[model samples]
Target: MAERLTTQQVAEQLGVKVETVYAYASRGQLSSERAPGGKGSTFDAREVAELAARGRRTPMRPNAAGEPPAGEPWASRPVTVRTGLTLIENGRLYYRGQDAVELAARHGFEAAIGWLWGLGSDAPVTLRVPPATAEALARASAALPDGIRLPDRLRISATVAAALDPLRFDLREQTVQAAGAALIAGMVEALPRTAPDPGPDASLAARLWSRLASAAPAPEALACLDRALVLLMDHELAVSAVAARVAASARAHPYAVVSAGLGATDGPLHGAASPLAHRLLGEVLVGGAVPVVSDYLRTGRPIPGLGHRLYPEGDPRAVALLDAVGRLDGGAAVVAAVAEVEAAAGPAGRPALRANIDLALAAMALAAGMPAEAGEVVFAVARTPGWLAHAVEEYREEPLRMRARGSYTGPRPSEGPERPEHPVPSSS
Candidate 1:
């Protein structure tokens, strides 16, 4: 008989969690069998070692004919986009081959944007709107009813900024980079400042802090915000990034590309998670995490900001930002609340749901005394440069390559009402 390893042993061997061990068994990547008396599952020792080796090897790529290697997860995807910007693998993220966490730690948000855009790491990246454009944005923003969400303000600003830019259609690399910087600047500047302006020479994080919070930021709090911005800058082919790329494929201007991305980001599963998490964290802080977590599970609602499919082990961005948030003066309580929520939700003998970036964003917002929607605003502004970076890549591809052919599932022509040989044209 072959040696058998317990679930925990297999997880340790694979450098994953017990949940991931079960996932591997379910996916047929590894096999498991009931232990004595059906107590728990055990894996064959050789099989565990082989799976670990496979995980360690670089992922196989498609051949010259573009056929994916056998058992590739993305083999069914019809359209493949080649990019040099970001990569997410082995539960870690990389931007242009540099570790994303390391980049966020070492550089500012603007520098990260410049780096992602293929601009040099030291490139002079300034996010500033022309005074005339800023004024127009302010006027447009003022016409909106009070109490509009921050993301809506960003949408309006993008539209107005587009209208003001005569060269918005230029797809040249430098032009796109310039427009992206200005668009981000305009979006941040368009929000009504809750605190005094931090001045033009201040970092983008300082400028954004003024808009999100009424109180002046401590140095550590400001650094946390800056880290979040850099970490959220680009994620490879996220849903919103894909939407932005599709618009770019059709030769839409940079502003329209962002609009498409924003439209996709307004849903609960994406940009909206932060606000939901903020509310959840507030409840957890008021009541105990046990009751709050129990209530959510009892109501059959998914706890927001818990899991991310991309990072099965854990989200490095969350770990990084949460560490920064913990450094703030009153941040320990919020961080403790988060830890309690995680512990209550995971419990023992079940898959533990690790915190994602949304939860970290919520913690940052709560610790900084920013409003619930502040996290969503931060997400939108941070991802804007990412959408533009994707646009640049998509622009270089064949026009409309992302146009997908629909698989007809509706009633066939024979099953529908008979059509006339010549359809009548409608006349007014």
Candidate 2:
């Protein structure tokens, strides 16, 4: 064997997809060798390890105008996106200088997920739960109501129960991620199904559709939807995932942790908007696009199908998904109608109020014959992997319950040891 290894070998050694290894090399975090004949590259194992040892977390991001707050405004240390990228700069989306979209597309969902989780692979993290704790979670899961829907929600409860087994706050990152995955899988599988079996290649969405309704989904479109999972997998500190991480930090059981996530997800800001967008589409069709756009513009109200918070330049995910969905059966005309309506409406800074990824997903899911309620389920299912990955990340960095502060806006309402309270005057 030579003293050094090629880039391909380095990828094999690291157990990451090839591009990820190249990403590390590209970022100068991994050493590379110039080939004699051509443009190929190689790596030295010793050099790679040395560079890794020196590598560290120092998050850098653009603080562009109108960017959202990371809270803790008064704190000296501004939070940086160490493992995630937010607010694209100079037409680039980078997670530590690795092109996120390219990586996501090339390596599949799990690879991108691995990078987020700190383990950097599809590597399994198995925890040997003590018999006592295991038995306790089993009993609790059994005791849950028979008819309760939502597999992920049940897992939230199960994780909570599992945590009560007294081994929940384990510090290792792999342990947390693996345990969460296992818990979620159990909940999904255990749900009573009344439909045809999802084969090995069937996606979580495809499986969910079959389980929720007896309706079958097309194989090709379902695969696209599966890749859609990869696209939706992570965004920096989304509202629901924030709630999830907060709960995890408090040592909530995995079930309880994600339950907090699900609760937050129910709000209009996150999960509910997709269905609303769907309804808005229906209204636009019924009311006629011109009239609807005219009225909406007059009121200066935003249209549902157009625009997003993160992508002022346009959501890359939305662009990719819409393009992918365009290939679906009967997709083009429907998409064209929606696009025309949007272009007619989006003028000035509003930009035809272009529909984001959620709208496109809803459209595709509808075309695939999913029920009105199914989009949110698909969103939740896809997003959980990322949320749990983040939870594992947060768990690794700090000890439990990282003392989130709130503004004390109320009047000085305090009681002394003697408990001096304004006596209530009773009118007799």
The candidate scoring highest on TM-score is 1
Residue lDDT tens for model 2, 1-428 = 45777777766654456776776777666677786676688787786555433322222122323243222111112233243433255544554355656655565544555554555536423323344544555566567677554534444545554555454556465556666655544444444454687753444445555655455656656556655766776666778877877776665655566667777767656865666656655555567677777877789876664676667767777666667667778667556656766776767675456667677766665556555545566676667666676666555443333444355688785565554378778799
- RMSD in angstroms, all models? 12.6, 15.8
Q: Candidate 1 lDDT (Cα, whole model)? A: 0.88
Error of 1 at 32 (Å): 33
Q: List model 1 lDDT by residue over 1-428, tens digit each.
A: 99999998987776666776786788787788999999999999998877666545534454434454332222112367999999998999999999999998999898998899888679858899999999999898888999898989999999999999999999987899899899999999899999988898899899999999998898888889999999999899899999999999888999999999999889999988999999999999999899999999999999999988999888999999999999998899999999988889995898778899999999999999999999999999999999999999988875655766455699676877788999899996
For candidate 1, the clash count comes to: 0
The regions of model 1 sitting more than 4 angstroms off are: 1-77, 415-428
Q: How close is every model to the real structure, measured as TM-score? A: 0.79, 0.64
Q: Looking at model 2, which ten-residue stretch has the lowest summed lDDT?
A: 69-78
